[model samples]
Target: MPFIDEPAGTTPMTDTAAHGAASPWWQDRTPQEIAALAAADGVALLPLAAIEQHGEHLPLSTDLDIALGLVDAALPRVRAGVPVCVLPPLAVGLSLEHSAFAGTLSLRPETALAVMVELGERVAAAGFRRLVLFNSHGGNKALVDLAALKLRVECRMLVVRANYFRFAPPPDALPADELRHGLHGGALETAMMLHLAPAKVRSGRVGNFDSLGRHLAAAGRLLGPEGEAGFAWMAQDLNPCGATGDARLATPALGDRLVQHFARQLARLVEEAHAFDLARLDGGALDRAD
Candidate 1:
């Protein structure tokens, strides 16, 4: 059943498991807790990450690890009584580009979308009317946007798909040489892993991979792993190493700074987006043709 409309104020905070109770924040909770939270402060943060290859040095779960890390970091900044539950990170995503690499678990775009839509409906039904999809993997960006659109129409829930990097800058801001865009396992990502999970980052393994460094230097963009120097999809373009950019410069200090800055930016975005008005979305203005 749809939740009853709450009075303008008098919302309550949900009780955490720490209070001698066992209801998990995301999976299960009492109806009174949900209603009280909806009245006081209603916002849900869904951490989205990929379980794909990040080269030999990083673990397959690096993206999800960092995403969960952000959730931990942001909890304090949320409203004191708000029921800010960190939904389990979606650990698998569209990784067709990195399929050549071992241990890369790729999900069809549609599957990813379906999972998010289902989760959105459940949360909205439980009175978490404001939903934010906090994404850690780049590949999940488009699909998250699609899921947000679908959820808005079907569930009337406000879903915002946020990318951490979209709000934050790299530590020392990495000179232009490093900013040259590539696909997987690049400088920014490497630095992030180093900061969030230092034990997992493989900085020494940067060598013997990606000859396309020279091409990126010369062409200003990665021309794929083979230096093909042409436009192509992830599967056709990237190589088997699961790396696209230089990882040599990645350091734990750099990673720490990146994560801190990223967290600050994301916390601010969540606060601003928390009060966002979804009914104002101009869907009628959109044209099918680009």
Candidate 2:
């Protein structure tokens, strides 16, 4: 489905509707208003992020800010027919790998799972049948996958676990090796920060780090030649700065492209999720072995 841009002079539904405005923000609506919105088949977007170190050049809230920025950019682009409610972000996630670094706050994997499950349950109870777990941090991927599965069974809701970076436009200016292995505090992330929050980025402090080599070494050990299996590793093990990739190559122009690309894809996902048919699936059709 194509993204629908609002026509000029048209105000958001939030400004004119009594069932809470069409602002697409959960925090902006009252409890009663939310109840009404839930009854209207609104989809709830919950941003999952981490408060961790992003090297000396970037602020600790890099993931959190990027998640929120993506949401802010996408909500407006959602088709007018889909009513979306953006929930306040869960900033602290599973970041134990980065705990060795200062300014890194993390929750254990189990704790993070519990928090996400409870949040999903609460939102499901609030009359929302669609919940999107929008994650920005790499460490939170496993937690989100688990939560999405359990929430589907327990809450009986359509849960979507989306990683923002997965929607980013491929970097043409950077090398394929760097783009593939630079998972954190890298050129992609730094550029995103430059576009979303330039004040928090220390451009002068940015430098190159060789995380790709470490990542490959770890992958070779944990993952077989086919890259099927995985092993555990810490952020420090990858690089001294607790970051990967080359940050010195980050530019505001690249950041803008990334942000816009991610936002557009995210908006499309939200629209599709809102229109998904949860009742059509045949749960009993497949055998466990199949």
Off by over 4 Å in 2: 1-21, 171-173, 212-227, 282-290
Estimate, for each residue in 12-65, the C-alpha lDDT of model 1 and write its tens digit: 332432456433256565566566666655688888888888777778998888
Q: Model 2, 194-232: lDDT tens per residue?
A: 999999998888988777354565665555211355457
The 0-to-1 C-alpha lDDT of every candidate, in the order given, reads: 0.69, 0.84
User: How far out, in Å, is residue 252 in model 1?
Assistant: 1.3
RMSD of each: 6.2, 7.0
- Model 2 gets an lDDT of 0.84
Query: Could you tell me the C-alpha RMSD of candidate 2 in Å?
Result: 7.0
Superposed Cα deviation of residue 123, candidate 1 (Å)? 1.3
Worst 10 residues of 1 by lDDT: 12-21
Our model 1 lands, by Cα RMSD against the true structure, at: 6.2
